[model samples]
Target: GLLRIDHVGIAVADLDEAIDFYERTFGMRCVHRETNDEQQVREAMLAVGPEGGVVQLLAPTGPGSAIAKFLDRSGPGVQQVAYTVRDVTAAAAALRERGLRLLYDEPRRGTGGSLINFVHPKDAGGVLIELVQPAGA
Candidate 1:
């Protein structure tokens, strides 16, 4: 079953500037930041609201990165909506059973140590949807 909204991912040209803007405008503190080499991007996670909602800011590391491509085409904006799930593999299987297209055949390690997979935008009504199984489960 779905747990809650894990985070809303935003693609930006500069992670630092995006972090600063969110901090200054919304008073949101960035709780964590890291560069994921496998994903080829730098990211910062900001806490929002009282119940563990997060805003994930992503900046591509190079022109080859997906975020960079997205920025090139879309000009930096909401990239994906992530939802917490008990088991990403299970959720993915279910989605596949329902004829939904997944971006990858298997889940991969994502930021914050979670296992994650993306639902194809075309199948998800033009919005990328991420299914995340948190670190422990």
Candidate 2:
């Protein structure tokens, strides 16, 4: 089952610039940053408040990356919403059994060593949904 809100992802053209803007304007703290080669994204996780809300900033690694396509089609903006889950495999299986289409056949490596998978946007309204199983959780 889903545990809680993990992070809200936002697509950006410039990762460093967006990190600077969020930290400067919203006072959010950049808690983690990394690049996922397979996913073709460079991302940063920002802590929003004392309650532990997170906003993820995602930038494309190249022109052909998904983030780049998202930027071209929609401009920089909210890209996906994620939920933390105790067991991503189980959660994904449950969702699959319910007739939802998962983007990947198996969970893929996500931020901070976590396992993650996505539900097709077309299967869940127009919003991309990510299910995250936190590292060591």
Per-candidate alpha-carbon RMSD to the true structure = 1.0, 0.8
Per-candidate TM vs. native? Answer: 0.96, 0.97
lDDT tens per residue, model 1, 28-127: 9899999988889999999885666889999999999999999999999999999999999999999999999988888999987999999999998999
lDDT of 2 by residue, 17-67 (tens): 999999999999999999999889999999988787999999999988989
Which regions of candidate 1 are displaced past 4 Å? Answer: none
lDDT of candidate model 1 versus the reference: 0.93
Q: Model 1: how far is 75 from its true place, Å? A: 0.4
In order, how many clashes per candidate? 0, 0
Model 2 local distance difference test score: 0.95
Model 2, runs deviating above 4 Å: none
Q: In candidate 1, which residue pairs get closer than 3 Å at backbone N, Cα or C atoms, i.e. clash?
A: none
Q: Which candidate wins on lDDT?
A: 2
